[model samples]
Target: MSDTMSETNRMTETETERQEGYIPHAKQVDFSSFDEEMLRKTFPNSVATDVSLCAEGVLMTARSKSNDPQVTFNISDMYRAAGYKQTATGSCVPFAPEDVKTIVLKIKGSTSGLLEFFYATGSLTTATADCSVTGSYIGGEDWWYVMLDLSRQRNGQYTERFNNGCRIDWSTDVQKGDTFILGEMLFFSNRSEGKAYADSRNKIASTTIGKTGYGDDMPAEGVEAGYYVCLYQNKLGSDAAGVSATFGTTGLEDAISFCNSRKQLGYRVSDEKGNVVYAPYTLLQCDILREAKYVTTYARENHFTYGDAPINPAINNRAKKVSCDRLVCWVMYRVGFTDQPFTQGVVVSAMHTWSEENGFIEITDKNDLQPGDIILVKPNGSGTYALHTFLFAGAARQKGMYFRYDHGSDTRIMSHQPNVQELELPGAPFWRAYRPVATATNNIYYDRYYAD
Candidate 1:
């Protein structure tokens, strides 16, 4: 055990056996500054469906059964590219569950014994996946709300790993043109804290299905109408998990001819480290992905400019038009950081104001970054004239490292692959990192921290 942030997840029982908890020396050793060639050789191209890096000698791989479709996947050095083969493995993303106290999924369908869902620890394939089935029932005519408590032990399965992600396993009963809509799924942290919310649904018609220890309140008036256009439909000829089909919303259908759209491979992210980096919280990360998809398809539909802010995303829900900074802010607000500086907010004195006055602390050392921390960006040589901001997905560099993001590249959302140390930061070329210190406010994600 070292003072490194990994202490939280890497501390071993052996260290505890000594009675004196051990923490290794703490020093900021910039690995990117190390010989780039040697670093590459040391970290050769390897693949894991769920990959996590530790500073010391431990390279952890979360495994699941690997009965993958016969399609071959082209793996590469970027590493993340390996996780992109949804067609082959049937990935239904936007299924990030970054740990939450509870997961509530509501669905409507035609038939049921149990609203069975397939969940795996690794890729849906047989090699690494830890697959299992859970049972739920239809409440009213065809609706069911499944709530799960992660705080208490579940299934009594003596395993330490938590499920990464899950999606509905469409049954043979499902036929083309049949209606199967997944209403809103809610992921909330501090589940025991939300018992009052559960009580509110006591007499509600929608909760009749929730008699299962997990809260099941589904008042018709309370439950928002299902987004019919957005609901999942069993299109003809697309029964294979990774098979494709096309459907589109009316708004875009008219704008872009609601042309054919394919199905999500339905791969949900799983968190094996107990890092709370998957599920409920991952759902927020999906917001970033969803918004990015919107921008990719409709960037032309939006107008971009600095100084202008998108309407409160909680209400407007999407950035109609936005500058790079506004896109970051819109996402922060929508991810449940309802406090200002983000929600219903605007840029303040460039990025520093938010990092300083608001609760975010700018990181002086890149190694200190945890997931959800943000790195600031500006045009080359554009000192203090900070032009952009995006969520930090992970670190990939040793010196001033190359990090990744599913966010704004320039003005439009794209993949993140920037070196913080390489970016221009006014004085020297040092990168600036800022993140809200972990704290709970009326907002749930008030101070989000990745697994330490």
Candidate 2:
């Protein structure tokens, strides 16, 4: 394929994240109607991931680029996750609507782990748990995504029902252009309490979602001053938590528990100093399906080739090439970070092969595979099955029982008939089961870099 077609096809699925006005969570509140503009002002410093609303509830994502083994955000006034637009109205046009039924929050990382997601409101000066969020270890790409249901309660007071020690502060009403902060504030002593891996959003402030934030007050040590956020979004936390109570709450919470209970630094959402507001982070009601498709399509469209692009390419000009996206997604699915978004490339490159020895399928002589192992299948290269990668979700010895797989070409993950197509493999086809492991390259810093 010519480079022009390759470039155009690749850009097809990519969407530019530009600045857009925030929309309120409430139906009656039209943040878009007002002629509001974001005012420039310095933010307070604290340590803890915070979450709030600007025109609406925003999603935040981030990563750790540093070599630090562990980090956290635990201060007041620090925005663990937040979004706001300073309005000339002088009145707060709340980001999150009082009647908002739910908020779905999603996050991810490179390792199979868990992260803590917190929701806090009111002045960062006074810290309270608006809501505590989490994403479980949904394998493969070390990603996590969950939904928070805030619509259940009309009152602002935090309720014990969801373990969120937060209640909408009667003192500060939600407002437009009102400052919504997330992830560490600088007010507390320990600033490195909350940190996220990678984040994205369709609503919330562009600054707060996937990165870290900062405030003026500096503590003796730990973390730095600035907006340390991960991702941002609009309307609803999104993901996992559809528009249901029983299903979302139970399923999401249960998933989180399963991932966190494990050993890896696993917990949904980064652990920050914010209050828990909702429960059972389900998939975002807005675009869960669309986003899933986008991720899969992006992977299929763009691929990396090591030694010059493949020659003669296979069918559809799909030469033998490695796909990190497919592998990571499958691994993540097996591990448990379900409903999460993964865009970054995988840790290892995929291998392409062309052979006629075996029919178009490269079958391994070994039968050792587990629930969370990586399953690779290459076409004998005769153009039979071409090339494919499967994430092992489950395996059964029962008759006609195929290994559970997540197809990199499609959006769904499932087990299917083994690839009949054959491809050349100098050695045995690689189908080794792998457990998610954390590596030094896995960690990334969201905000400013720390001197080593």
Candidate 3:
């Protein structure tokens, strides 16, 4: 982006005088009702000429130049930075720096570019920002969320710079004529709250329902309740005694013992400091489902390419084309399973070989299948090998023998189908199942049979 300004390059004479005698205000700015006046005041030093308010939000057109374009939001008013607006008539409330942990930006209709965030004090023309973060955005017409973590500022000394305003700089990767809509802007006190807000708007479905052995159907014997039980016990500590008791287990140890007896098919346990202590299944199925939602949504919205060959020209597009194997590898990598690379020409056989090389064990019996397991479809004839592969979501609702799975294929490049759905195959024997390994390091799990 732009070079850091020096004190000599501060604001104009009039603006500098206002800054010198300025008194802090406890009033906040209402972003929902943001108008042209508010927009101009927020970015007094912006060089772009075409900044206006649209139905979606604020619209800004990048100027053609060598230096990167920038839009800085003046947060000298701590209340505004904290996401609280001053009423027409009410007591002025104050917020400390620690009260806000992240600044979230909702953006839409932008070209491929790098968005960088920085914190600055004093005039935008002169102040130097010591803290900076960069995030990438794909060129698309859909809305996406960006969150900047302020908690990591200056080794957790973010509170010391509470009054510093925030600046957003866009890299030249965003073309000159490209335009983007700046939607709702807000501040949250924690990462979970920010993520929740984005997840709500993004329409991410919950993975807790429709599972046989989890959620509301958790057994009284606590056999299939390992995920929730471990999560609660780790989060609650001694307070988890009641939860364990209610589940017919004495304590965390009892629940863990039951989980271990099932061949590490339960949830992974993490310590208070966020370190993984016991990882049953490489990662939680719920986490895998969450990442799947984002990946599928992104691919559909961005019109991801589709190809099968090693060096297909169609794959050269801005959003590279991917086969079913590439899609599966992408989802696994997103959730901390980085054993394989996202390469072209990755076929079902490659995945099978990779699983074998890793600790993933083969499961001949369908009853041993669990959520997040990889199932390779048996070849059509005796001459060929397994051709199609998918991620098992859960057992289907029907009694006979059907299962839900998340699938990705050349046909689903633009379609939203194969989004955690169930399909009736010829029979269960048509597919070969592979269970992930369980270890404290890998955090894999494999559970057998759904009990009533």
Candidate 4:
């Protein structure tokens, strides 16, 4: 992959974020949306990530790369970022038609990886033409706000209250993973809050869905800005009114009792912050389907060499030899579960696998071999002290059960059935599984240097 491709594709993954925009909760009038003073107070300026980015409940998808060449949209992972432009205008699903006056297009994001801003507006709608406005960032400033003067668009444009359509036009090709959001194109009343309360749409789309939970104004819940956040609530006021018991543990028992009294389950989003850490199932899927293909690649590169690279060039190409151990370790480390010593002891040991010390637990139970779990192998029962490790890609076609194995060779992680020796050896090859301990609530961040 190209450096640019890797950089762009690997970043900005919205893994299992709350979908759609905000809904007024519990029959409450949205006191959240700010008027002029509140708007300025709520957002003296706009921040892209802070705001939801949908328009009319759905942010417009990429049209073409450049009719508005100044813009770029990333729709899916691994696909090339393209220039998008508006191709046609179709719908006008306004949230509140009567309150459309000072429509604000508060854009806060970058282009070509450089911070840039774009905002535009045109005339109000009538039976004839539609309202329109367009402009690029005037300054080097990558962020800015544009409060559209809808009154001016209304003054001489249309005398009647015909709903100006909120339709957008796009001619460019959208790809597989492209997902347009709803909060992206929301417009607020000059007096009311946009469906999104914040200057940006993210507020409306995901309340408190920023880097932190809810919103930043929400105090750090005893978490030093980590994925694992714990709410240390206080019961200092001593409200015994609803409580029949006084089980204590930092308000948790009280909270639980309150729910139990009503026969409800009170809970939090994450136990820690495990849900957002790279998804465990997806990570496993990659290990099973994707990592299995690397064996051939590894073998070709190493030519089955046992140790590190820089294999002596003088050695005959066919004579070069490599061990499957290196291939297995390479696959494990690549998928972010590198905890074993690169030696035979860890490979075949009933205990002391490197993963035991890392952020993983050993799965000794025979029934726990799930696909994507890493497995240590002594190909045939006649396993030797020297064993090989591979991924538990999936199940096989045998009557009882056959595990489809995948591991790296000097060239690649084997994509096909490995060269399993049917020969049996005492204590030769033992099979065991390693499962990552991270989950939707528990995760390890100390070693996770890569951006989520």
Candidate 5:
């Protein structure tokens, strides 16, 4: 046999592959930018229930079956989107187990059994060709949480066994055809004997079936309470997955009323006039006022801003809002901030400044400020010397807080700040921050990237 054939056989027999064992030539050919839209078209596994382009990288959610809902996705698709391709004969991306430090799955599954998640790590040698599966238990029910970080591995391969699973991985390759397969959030069941169907109790409660899912109709506690009202509910019935709902009279009425009430609080409410209205700043404050917590500290301790035109920048930006503001608002509103701006600036920024030099302070500049850092401010006031500051908490509402609070209405809570001019600097900062937060949702403007 030739010398090359002999060397390959020896290495395979001994599992002695080194990092420099195979030096593949780097191609010099240029190609179009990695197009996620295009990359998704290549594989059956590309479709995801949710897809998000984040600071760390692209994140996607797909459905599968196992002990519960299992999620899987591929690094290969990301690589292709990043402009890499798989060689014709190659298995695709050749990844060492150590390269991946974290793997997470936001799961929803049956409670009876543990959920198993799998990943396809194309191997460099035939002896190591095997899939890796990771398992976890979400107890029971359709719940969600971050999964394991199997960065630690034995050898250059990783493997786990379970009844069923799905996974998401980042591949090292960027070429077409040669890509890793990925999936996310799959449902797994305890009974491995056959498919697990929803029990009779799994059906949407008959009381909730036709009634509006939000407002007083929903439970005060638990997963089923509150409405995620969608303005387009009437337009897109069952087909609508994100926000659209099917209930008619009550559903439509509740949605409209909620939006209209919040319209005064810088929250955007779409109208037939082809004009978008903004809520007022006071409304944001009042939202917190209503949700006042006894622990008050935690609830408002890390509060932030929620508009395009914040009082300042740095502390009052978008990232902070999504990670903090919006989440808190959703939680408190669910807990009982039924009034306008249900969870507005005050409550949103409540936790901002607890000490002497604290309160919501807008930064005239963002580039100079670091995230999670506090924002300080000194607003002009009639008092001797006004120096109040709120933590530069963060931005919660993107699309720059819109509501009926026109400056003309001095009593208005949520107010409309012009998208351009006057609040430009502060508003501009909010838009940049909102870009990433808005991308998290596959809502109405799903096709459009973040916009002011």
Candidate 6:
């Protein structure tokens, strides 16, 4: 948020940094220390007099007789397209059209006028734009974060014509003295690096899954092709209703029963004196448990049962029994990290080894874990290395503990058995965590089809 001249200066990446896939581009434009010579070198076509650096950001003032003021960013060097010359060279490598996913802009100005964006194809002087999107400002003085999803643009061929650069057109509603400020402009690539992967995972986790099913209502395009779990494939049978049934065992069902018995799991637990007591779970933990329950129920209901197949078939095969590792694979595939339930070994130990060999970095501290991180558990009361795998949902009800979406064991026919449980972190079984390297790929389950 700092508008300091030094902080708003353009970022330059070295050859090694560009080669390493660093997203090299302009961070902010400081008008206060405006350099007309550098602006000409960078944009070439932009009018230096149209904008000035303000205390907040780059402020643009409407010119007399021009109702629709605009700003142009000639970013030919940042994109690979035909018929365009790079105004500034050697700064960074141009990205392919498909590599770019979204364009985010932070702006604040007139609330009445529309802020329009246009992506020019071959030339900026063209009468028509290849693609365009319209957005509104937040009015007042608050910044509005507007996101334009390039993939959803009307012109599918826009990528081919991405050479001319892009323009922002303010609506004619502005008067001569009307003004607006451009805070930031960022172009996000489709490549599965840290930010891109985290954004995709967060979007999927928040919008795709519901309390009742695992993306049952999600569009086919929203899911990774070939690994799409159809609505019919996610059936929570009567076994889901058995959570309230008495079970002498101490696994998933028991956990759910205990949670139900004391509504105090996620809420604050108070003493008889009505004094403040410890809160076992956070509200986020409660929401995670609700969603995890549905995932567990669906896995138990639809996985390939014993003797149902020679081996566990692909998830698309609509088999009925899913092991803990396969369940993790399903979660990853749903999150667009893999194509199918991981093609790596089906056993927990082999998957754990594959994770280590691949770009999955090990995390010894549980506090470093994120919501979508993969959690590997050592066998309880034994020396077995990796006996189970699940996702680190989020923080648990208890302090210093986390929640996990676990498909407890391989297929079991018992109606009282819970395939998945939202368990506290490192309580019953010690856990080792692995954070996936989003950009890394391998011949096994880690493929670029989903990541890209």
lDDT per residue as tens, model 2, 62-171: 22111111112221111111232222322222222332333332332223332333444343343345354333233232223333333333356533222212222110
- Which portions of model 1 miss their true places by more than 4 Å? 1-307, 310-319, 341-344, 348-350, 379-385, 396-403, 406-411, 414-431, 445-452
Candidate 4 lDDT score relative to the true structure: 0.31
Candidates ranked by lDDT:
3, 6, 1, 4, 5, 2
Best by lDDT: 3
Error of 4 at 349 (Å): 5.2
Candidate 4 local Cα displacement, residue 64, angstroms? 47
Please write out the lDDT profile of model 3 over residues 42-80, one tens digit for every residue: 666665435677877777777753235776665654233
Quality of model 2 by C-alpha lDDT: 0.27
TM for every model, in the order presented, reads 0.32, 0.24, 0.36, 0.28, 0.20, 0.34
Specify the highest-TM-score model's number.
3
Order the candidate numbers by TM-score, best to worst.
3, 6, 1, 4, 2, 5
- CA lDDT of each prediction against the hidden true structure: 0.34, 0.27, 0.48, 0.31, 0.27, 0.44
Worst 10 residues of 2 by lDDT: 184-193
What local lDDT score does residue 68 receive in model 5, on the 0 to 100 scale?
22
Model 4, clash count? 69
Clashes of each: 48, 163, 8, 69, 80, 13
**C-alpha RMSD of candidate 1:** 23.1
The CA lDDT at 270 in model 6 is 20
- lDDT, residue 369, candidate 3: 72
lDDT of 1 at 320: 51
Runs in model 3 with CA error above 4 Å?
1-32, 65-67, 77-94, 159-162, 203-452
Candidate 1 lDDT over 334-425, as tens digits, reads 44555554344555235566556557677878667545555665534646645556556443324544433323434334222221333334
RMSD of each: 23.1, 22.1, 15.8, 20.5, 21.4, 23.0
Error of 2 at 71 (Å): 42
